[model samples]
Target chain A: MKYINHEELLKMEPQYRVQVINSLSGFKSANLIGTRDENNINNLAIFSSVFHLGASPALVGFISRPDSVDRHTLRNIQQIGQFTINQVNADFWQAAHQTSARYSDGECEFKQTGLTPHFIDNSDAPFVKESQLKYALKLNEIVPIRLNNTLLVIGEITDILCDKAAIKADGYIDIESLNTVMVSGLDSYHTSKRLSRLSYAKPGILPTKISLDGKS
Target chain B: MKYINHEELLKMEPQYRVQVINSLSGFKSANLIGTRDENNINNLAIFSSVFHLGASPALVGFISRPDSVDRHTLRNIQQIGQFTINQVNADFWQAAHQTSARYSDGECEFKQTGLTPHFIDNSDAPFVKESQLKYALKLNEIVPIRLNNTLLVIGEITDILCDKAAIKADGYIDIESLNTVMVSGLDSYHTSKRLSRLSYAKPGILPTKISLDGKS
Candidate 1:
């Protein structure tokens, strides 16, 4: 086993440290955050930080880097009060990765990456037409992390569009069936195979794998 | 495709809603957070919410549910000011999942789950001996999300232990080699295969997959 202390980690190169620390947390959710500027110019960027914050209110949150520089996604959310989160799949992960490039404010990533954007039910933000699973979120709150100067943008789920067949009876979406991709660090991509789904844990009982067809 | 509006989503059964919303975000990192109470009683709980916050200071954050019920993990972190995040792998994910059961405050989940607890460099918190990758964190700041009454606990990386062979020259850890399992919703587990790792994106140039052996 390799052991690294704080002092050693701090002395590493900046880019190397970023790769190490980012991948250290393990696999992250891969999604493209879609937003539109005041002129209705669409902007999309790949984000791996989005996580489920709460279920009752259906809240989700993602970390936005410092606002010292231009952040079109954050700016658009603040202005339009809405955005979309589309899961990145195998078919479009490369084009989705290209959205991370520093494009000019007026340029739309959707057009540049050849990803079609469509507005659903007159949504304020655009959704990726190629994404199999996507949802729209209304801006709920933004909490500032003074420790790192980053912002935690929280949103409430307002709408969802998904393949109905992928949803199980108990409401678990079979991601493996959707071919949704998972990301590691800043560049690595992966596709997963279901290992098993276990029954709810109890004190003395051992958990057994439950079937995907809603059988325990 | 299935379209679910906000009203419909709000009307679903609570457990079904949890399963749907939790899996809606796609794959999540599987980790076991280790903390010790004031009396040095160790506690371990499975969490899928850990996400990377920043790299400069090597910070990470996880959400703690509302304090309406007993939350030993949050309480221990507040009292001891330190904790360990251990990645969940195939060998012991069942035991790790069992940690989610509500154990009494004084009871140690580590012992009950059949996981060995070991201290490194006399660290305040105990780490899972069965885990291949683990890190110790010192409490940095606690930010309350008033929207849902949840708390986001931030921590700074202080120590790391991992299998050296899994780390690449560019600092990306090959999670496939580590056999780390990812979680979807509350119970599903998965193992992943590497798709590809792309080069950094630039304005006009297309990114090509880089080999793990340092060849582009």
Candidate 2:
């Protein structure tokens, strides 16, 4: 095993340190966050930091850096108060990754990556047409992490659109069936193989594998 | 395609809604957080909400519900001001999931789940002995998500221990090669296959596959 103490980590080259620190968090969701500015310009950027916050309110949160390529996304979401999160799949991950490229405020990543912008009646934000699972979110809160100057943007799900076949009877969306990709560090993409869904854990009993369908 | 509006989502049964909403966040990192209370009780809980916060100060953050099984983890971290985040690998995901069982205050999940507790001189928190990639962290900040009543606990990395073979030339840890598993919809565990590591995206240039060696 390799051991890196705090001082050693701090001494690492900037680029090397970034990769190491980013990858340390393990696999992250690969989602393209879609937003439209007040000017109606569509913005799409890949994010691996999105995580579930709550279920009853259907809240989701993602970290945004004020100064990175994500600045456009952060700015757009604030201006419109709504955004879309679309899962990146195997078919369009390359184009999805390209959305992270730094583009000027006037540019649209959809056009640059040849991905189509999708519109819905309820929200101004655009969704990725290539995404099998997508949702619309209205900004609920922006909490600043003064420690690192990053913002944790929380949003409430307002609308969800997905392929009907992916939803199981019990409400689990078969993302593996949809070829959804996961990300590691800053640049690596991966597709997963299911290792079975375990049954609910209880203090005295071990959990067994449950069926994908609701019948279990 | 199936469309679910916010009203319809809110009307679903709680069990169904929880599963659906959790899945909508897409794949999440599977990590077991280890902490010890002042009474010397070790607490281990599986968390899917951990995400990378920043790279320079080597920050990481994860969500903890004050009322859920995570309360033990939250309380322990607040007491000791330190904890460990261990990547849940394929071989022990079942056991990792078991750690989520609602064990009592005196009950140690490490004992209940049969996962060994490892200790080093610098911190009192226990690391999972079976994890190939594990790191120690000191509590940085605890931001309250007032909307959901959940807490976002931030930590700064202090020590990292990993299999040296998993580290690439440029410092990207090959998590897939380390057999780390991802979680979806609370119970479903997954092992990933690397699609590719892509070059940094540029406005007009498409990202190409970069070798693991980082020589490109």
Candidate 3:
């Protein structure tokens, strides 16, 4: 086994530390967040920090890097109060990854990456057409982390669009069927195979694997 | 494609809605958070909301359910300011998942779930012996999300222990090598296969897949 203490971690090279610390948390959800500026110039960026915030209000949140430089996604969400989250699948993982590159404020990552800007039923934000699962969100709140200067942007799920076949009776969307990619750290991509979906856990009961056919 | 609007989503059954909305963001990291109360009573809980907050200071954050209920994890962190996050592997995921059950205060989930509590360097918190990757964190800050009533507890990484074989030369941990299982929604566990690790993305350079042999 290997061990790294706080002092040693702090002394590590900046980029090396970033890669280590980011990957330390394990796998992260990979998604492309799309927004449009006031002039409607579309912007897309890949974010792995997106996490489920709540369910009743269908809320989701993602951390935005420190606002030291221009952040088109945060600016657009603030201005329009709307954005879209598209799952990064194998088909567009590279293009989606490319969105992370520092592009100018006015530039459209969709055009640069060759991924289509998809408009779904008057959504103010664009969705990745290549994405099998996508949804639109309206900004609900922005909480600032004073420790790091990063903003945790919470949003209410406004609309969800997905292939009907991917949804199970219990509402689990089969991500593996969609080839949705999961990321470790900042650069590694992975495709997962569902090991099992266990039944709701209880105190003394051993969980039984739920069948993929939506039956116990 | 199937589309679910906000109104329809709001009207769905509560548990069903939770399942749907939780899985909507895609796969999430599965980890067991271990903490000890003032009485030295160990508490362990499964958390999927943990996300990387920053890398420079090695910070991580996870959402805690509204404080309306007694949260041992939050209370313990507030009291001791230290906790351990152990990655849930396929071997102990069920035991890890069982920690989610509503347990009375002072009851040790580590004992109840049949997971061993291993201490290292006289750390205050326990780490799951079955976990291949585990780390300790010191509570840094807790930011409350007013919109959702959830608290984002941020912690600075202090010490990390992992199998030497799991880390790559570039600092990315090979989660697949460790067989760390990812979770979807609330219960489904998954094992991932590396699709490819691409080099750092730049403006126009095509990403080349980096070799796993610790070389470019």
* Candidate topping DockQ: 2
How much is the lDDT of residue A24 in candidate 2?
Answer: 92
Q: Can you give the lDDT of residue A60 in candidate 1?
A: 92
Which digits, one per residue and each the tens of the lDDT, describe model 1 over residues B144-206?
A: 999888999999999999899988898888877889999987899999988899888776777
TM-score of candidate 3 relative to the true fold: 0.97
List candidate 1 stretches off by more than 4 Å: A67-70, B68-70
> Local error of candidate 2 at A203, Å?
0.8
Ranking by DockQ: 2, 1, 3
**How well is each residue in A1-216 modelled by candidate 3, as lDDT tens digits?**
898987889899997788789887889999999999999899998999899989977899999975532288999999999999999998888888888778777678888899998897757999988999999999999888888888989999999999899888888888889999999987889999888888876777777788765468
lDDT of 3 by residue, B87-192 (tens): 9998888888788887788678988889999888837998888899999998999888877688889999999999999888878788889999999877889999
lDDT of 2 at A165: 100
DockQ (model 2, Cα): 0.90
Which pairs in model 2 have colliding backbones? none
lDDT of 2 at A91: 98
Which candidate leads in TM-score?
2
lDDT of 1 at B56: 86
Span of 10 residues, lowest total lDDT, candidate 3 chain B = B63-72
